[model samples]
Target: MRPKPVKPKGGQESVWDYPRPPKLEEVTKTIEVYFNGVLLVRSARTYRVLETSHPPVYYIPQDDVAMEYLVPSDRTTYCEWKGRGRYFSVQVGDRMEQDAAWYYSDPIGRFGPIKNYLAFYAHKMDKCLVDGEVVTPQPGNFYGGWITKDVVGPFKGVEGSFGW
Candidate 1:
């Protein structure tokens, strides 16, 4: 059964209202990721993917991320809207989160702007922030969308929400 969506208040956006195929929009606000007290990424220019039933996933440019901390992983996944994704393992000191980040080397025509950009799993990182506001990780293991204040939903990615 599909869960009823929560009513959005205070100018919030409902994930249920987002498009199925998803749309890419450039983010002008600051996007930051930190792990083990170290800054992994900080960028003013990023792109956000908004899809139905999911919070936005911000994709950071390769130049803005701490590339040394990311190691290429053999894992890969396919997204109907995007293309095949390549994974990356994040390492800070001795701690490592395998396949914690992903990027599409060659995206579909509509998602071409995000090609080669990286999006991290919020739960795997110590913290992720948008414009200084800490973000909540979207539930479940497979989806990597980040929840911020402006977005509202009974979002997908939680237990019992798989069919959404």
Candidate 2:
């Protein structure tokens, strides 16, 4: 059963109102990722994916990410709406996060803008920011959504909500 939708406050958007298949769109707001006391990514040119019961997932342009810190990983996954996905391990200084990032090299038409763009697991990073505001990672190890004040949710990926 679907959880009761949270009423949005102020300018906040309810995740329950997001579409099922998800919507991908360009975001001009700054997106940043920090780990191991180093700034790994900061970009205003990025894409965001919004889906039902989930927060937005920001995809940073490959050019904005520190590629030297990203080592390709053998792990792979699939998203029915986006197509194949591949994981990457991020290393900065002596610290490393395995399979902490992912991207789609060849996404379906609707998701084409995100091709080759990287999305990180916010919880795995020291900090992830959207529009200068710190983000809260969507609960659970499998989903990579980044929750911010602008979005409201009783989001999926929380304990006992796996079937959502």
Top-TM-score structure, candidate number: 2
The C-alpha RMSD in Å for every predicted model, in order, reads 0.8, 0.7
lDDT of 2 by residue, 1-164 (tens): 78888899999999999999899978999999998988989999999999999999999989999999999999999999999999999999999999999999999988998999999999899999998999999998689999999998898998878777
**What Cα-based lDDT does every candidate model obtain?**
0.93, 0.93
Give the least accurate 10-residue stretch of model 2, judged by summed lDDT: 155-164
Candidate 1 lDDT by residue in tens digits, 1-164: 77898889887999999997899999999999998878999999999999999999999999999999999999998998898999999999999999999999999988999989999999999999999999999988678999988998898988889777
lDDT of 2 at 123: 89
Model 2, runs deviating above 4 Å: none
> Which ten contiguous residues of candidate 1 have the minimum total lDDT?
155-164
Q: How many backbone clashes does candidate 2 have?
A: 0
